[model samples]
Target: MDKVLEGLKYAAAGAGGLFAYLFGAWDALIIALVIFVVADYITGIAKAATQGKLSSAVGFKGLLKKVMIFVLVMVGTVVDKAIPAANHAIRSAVIMFYIANEGLSILENAGELGLPLPKTLKSALEKMKDEKPEDVPAEEQE
Candidate 1:
């Protein structure tokens, strides 16, 4: 039992270190992104189940896409490091875009469940649709 506990501790430490290395320090933005991602996934499942469209394949694909989002964020972090002048700018932009995108998806899920959504929130997300990482300016990259 002691050996198993020690192994678990080591595994957790390794996972945490990898998360920090890839995502940088966990900030408010990151926390929000994580929450949004989870909420979106749960809502997606609910939506699919209600519509009788649930499939293991689709769920697995959604999981893969979620993992890919983190991978893309890691890529942005690496790119930011390559450009010494930029401090996490690419990563921040990438995360921000996903946050908004996931938030919109959640709202869509809510709407599917017959919940009313605010127009302003929808419009804000729509406006930010074009403000993705690639669309951000060099000056803002700092």
Candidate 2:
């Protein structure tokens, strides 16, 4: 039991390290992206179920796309690392783009389910899709 517990702890540590490396820092940007991705997926499933249009193939395809989002993030992080002067520029942009996309998708799914959305939030989400890191001033970089 002692050996098993020790092995589990090591495994958890390894997983945590790998997650940090792949996803970069766990800042608000990454956390929001993760939440948006998950909520989008759940809402998508709910939307399909409500409309009676659920299909295994479609779900699989959606899952593949979600996985690809992370792959892009990883690639962006790698590119940033390769360019010493780049301070997470690529990764931040990639994450922002996906976060907006996912948020929009979730809103769409909610709409399909007859949920009324706040106009301000709807507009904000629409704008987010086209946002770029450079568009914001350096003072608000944090």
Candidate 3:
């Protein structure tokens, strides 16, 4: 059993290393995105459970979507690498965008679960959700 556990640990580390390589460094942005993604999924499940609407198929779909988020980030990393001038810009942008999106989903789930959010925070999130990339100021886009 100990040997098996050791083997599993090694395999997990190998997989993580490959993931980090493909994603272009496991930095704070990626970490925040992961946290938000997981939190959104958990809150989604909780909200579904409260409403008695849980379905295995829907849950599986959600998992697929979550996985695809990382897949997209990997693609972003590839794009950044291909463009020598990009300097991880594409990957960082993709991660940040997903972090914000997942955060909004989590907040929405919280609201559905009857959790009271601060008025200012809720309004700010709502405003962010409404804003398009083009709507952001040129200086802030950097």
Candidate 4:
């Protein structure tokens, strides 16, 4: 009985360790961001379909851009590991950048569905979008 209990505990701990190794906080965040991005894209497409605004080409381009975001995150992970000292700074920034983008996109999705959004957040999003590319820091601008 004691041996069995120890074995079960070890197995559970090993599984948790695996999950933590594969899905660190930043990785988990990016996964959530990707889910939001996909949901937003689907809702936007559905809205377009209902409103006669469908465009396969534009949707494909948007998907490509989303793919680029993942590529950037992967690159950030590599940089993070390469540095081996900064304590996930690159990954954290990458996750934050994508989180902000996905959050804004989800807000747009909600708006398309006629859901109300906070005025301040909406205005801030507009301001962020309106800022010149050269003006915003590259990391934050993403």
TM-scores, all candidates, are 0.80, 0.85, 0.77, 0.64
lDDT (tens digit, per residue) of candidate 3 on 4-98? 99999999999999987799997898888889889988998999999999999999989998998899899999999899899999898788777
Candidate number achieving the greatest TM-score relative to the actual structure: 2
Candidate 3 colliding pairs: none
For residues 30-106, could you state the per-residue lDDT of candidate 4 as single tens digits? 67777867876787788778778899997897788777777777677677878989678877776666666666777
Off by over 4 Å in 4: 1-27, 118-142
Q: How do the residues 8-73 of candidate 1 rate in per-residue lDDT, one tens digit apiece? A: 999999999988888876789789888988998999999999999999999998888788888888
The lDDT of each candidate is 0.84, 0.84, 0.83, 0.70
Clashing pairs in 4: none
Ten residues in sequence with the least summed lDDT for candidate 4:
125-134
C-alpha lDDT (0 to 100) for residue 135 of candidate 4: 69
Better of 2 and 4 by TM-score: 2
Better of 2 and 3 by lDDT: 2
Clashing pairs in 1: none
* lDDT (Cα, 0-100) at 55 in candidate 4: 96
Per-residue alpha-carbon lDDT of candidate 2 for residues 1-142, written as tens digits (9 for 90 to 100): 9999999999999998998888887789989988988999899899999989999999998888889889989999989989868899989989988887788788878988999988888788778667546776734221
What is the C-alpha RMSD, rounded to one decimal, of candidate 4? 6.2
